[model samples]
Target chain A: MDTIIQTVTSITWQQIVMMVIGGVLMYLGIKKNYEPTLLVPMGLGAILVNFPMTGVLTQTINGQKTEGVLDVLFNAGITTELFPLLIFIGIGAMIDFGPLLSNPFMLLFGAAAQFGIFFVVIVALLFGFNINEAASIGIIGAADGPTSIFVSNQLAPNLLGPIAIAAYSYMALVPIIQPMAIKLVTTKKERRIRMEYQAESVSKQTRILFPIIITIIAGLVAPVSLPLVGFLMFGNLLRECGVLDRLSNTAQNELVNIVSILLGLTISVKLTAGSFLKVQTLMIIAFGLVAFIMDSIGGVLFAKFLNLFRKTKINPMIGAAGISAFPMSSRVIQQMAQAEDKQNFVLMYAVGANVSGQIGSVIAGGLLLGFFS
Target chain B: MSAALTQGFELMLFGMGGVFAVLFLIYLVCIALNRIFSGKPKE
Candidate 1:
């Protein structure tokens, strides 16, 4: 009876709060359809781990050590950095580099938009985080959840939960966040600016060679980024190779779905109340918004700056699509353009910049690893 | 500025510079490939 009472009373307010947060995440995922696949597993994991004396985590049983499934999964998948790399293969397979290949100049927006990662690192430092912690926190601006997890895992493992949540949450909120950021910086004229997209047909050889050359170039330039870029390009190679359709289909579907589940649940281990309920956690969340806003601003301003020299003006809003949130950011830009003026279609250009953002964020992650590690 | 602040600025410069440099190289490669392989304008 005493043992039962102790077990029942061991539940702290913090644990209850975490469980509620987890429930809210699940609710948001299921009802709102916001990253349901990731949020549902993460929410369930959070609730499971927070239950008093839960057996879901590794513990001593019968005076002997026994491994919990989540712990085993976390160790084998996340700590080894296998899950994110695997997810990259799926993401790489899904991406069609055609838009980007047609408009190669869009790559600059990808590079420019990453300014937030570095900018927020500086802000985080001022807020009293050490260089490594600051860098990890700033990576939330990468707008790529896997890259955020990969970088934070490498640099500041303790802050992984908040940073990962921030990255993904902000990614989902791109529609709300980016439009607000874009609206604040750009005038109505800039928002309504239309650029003609001439579909440049790329050769089959170029399609196949693009991934190979990019992987080689990125590896040579930033050797440390090899794992991040290599796996991504390898996946792209499988996709563009045209000989591995079955393998590509598996990578895009089964492999990604399985790894995403493991990745979400394993990441939830970092969400224990003891680690999550901190002033630093709040700061990470706040700084993540800062990073995202800065990324949008960086891209927009760079585009505006370029427009000064070019006779044929580029739409400044396309720059905001350069963050790595993919179709969401691109879609937001398209909606905003239509809102401003009907019959203005810039989705192709936005997508070009958007896909380049995928490559940009990965390289930025690699560069951060090289500089800090 | 404090030592941490100084280091932060240095990292910002290096990080942004490195990203731009890498992406610029990729851009150049794409351009070279397009010029070399592409036949003529389709439309």
Candidate 2:
């Protein structure tokens, strides 16, 4: 009772603000449906850690140190960089690289869309962050939640909570954000550009070899990317290997769900009022928005540039789908296409681009790790 | 003229180049794999 009274009386304005922020995140997660699995737990954690001398973080009672679950989880899971990598395994199992393997041309858009990751490196640098910090923050443009967590955990751990929030929040908002950026740079006729997509027959050998070959290529180019690329492709190998359906099913369903839940809650360990209320946090959020928007613009503009030389004009919106926001970016592009003309069934092409983004984001993350670490 | 700016540009040039280089290689290899392996037997 004494501790409770002391905690209530001693609570600072920052703590109060953090609780409010936590409440807002909860509202968004529950009502607005924005990355609910992550946001809900993260919001609750924000509220959990903010009370003075909160029990969720390590505390000394009578000069005896007591371990907090959140802190323990943070050290075991995040500090070791285990959670996000584990999440990648699940993501890999869930993804079908068939869309990507069918059309090699779409892979270029994957590389092209990564313009935002490097672009934000400059933007963050201009904002006075150090190289490693800038690099970690720049990864928000990967638009991949796990990649963002993985890179930032390695480079700018102190900034993990805000970066994670920004990555996931913006990803959930892809439906809203991407269309705005797509429409700004594309013409109605460009949006209406139609292309034929025939389901190509991919050999089982190609399917099995695809993950293995890409893993080798990633390893050769950026050896630091091995853990990330290796783990992701390992999951894909499990799916494609034909003998591991049971394990693949486990990875896609149970493994992903459990890890994502823990990963979501674990990231909030960094969201304590003292760390999360800084001026720099606001800057990270802003820069993240820039990264997201620039990524879409980069992809859209790339397709437009290609149209200049190609005899068969490509829908510039297809380029925007190159963002690793996955089905959301793909969905946004297709929706815009259908809105312009209902007969425009760009969904299959968008799926191809979307899956390409899955690979693109991991490579970009690996490259950032190689450069900085 | 800042060190951060220099580093940023260096990253931009090489990073974009590296992404394109690696993915472009994958593209060529993917094309080859289709021709070499398509219509083959399953395991």
Measured by lDDT, the strongest candidate is 1
Clashing pairs in 1: none
Which 10 consecutive residues of model 1 chain A have the lowest summed lDDT? A53-62
Scored against the native two-chain complex, candidate 2 gets a DockQ of 0.53
Write candidate 2's Cα lDDT for A1-373 as tens digits.
9988988898999989999999999999999999998899889889888876756888786688888889999999988889988988988898888878887788888888888899999999998899888988889999999899999998989999999999999999989888988889988888999988877878899999988998898888888888888899999999999999999999999998898888888888888889999999999999998888888899889999998999988898888788788778888888889999999998878888888888888888988888876
* Residue range with the least summed lDDT across 10 consecutive positions in model 1 chain B: B34-43
Candidate 1 displacement at residue A364 in angstroms:
0.6
Candidate 1 lDDT, A251-317, residue by residue in tens: 8999999999999999998888999999999999999999999999999999999999999998999
Q: Please list all clashing residue pairs in model 2, or write none if there are none.
A: none
Q: What is the TM-score of chain A in candidate 2?
A: 0.97
Superposition TM-score, candidate 1 onto the true structure: 0.97
DockQ of each: 0.73, 0.53
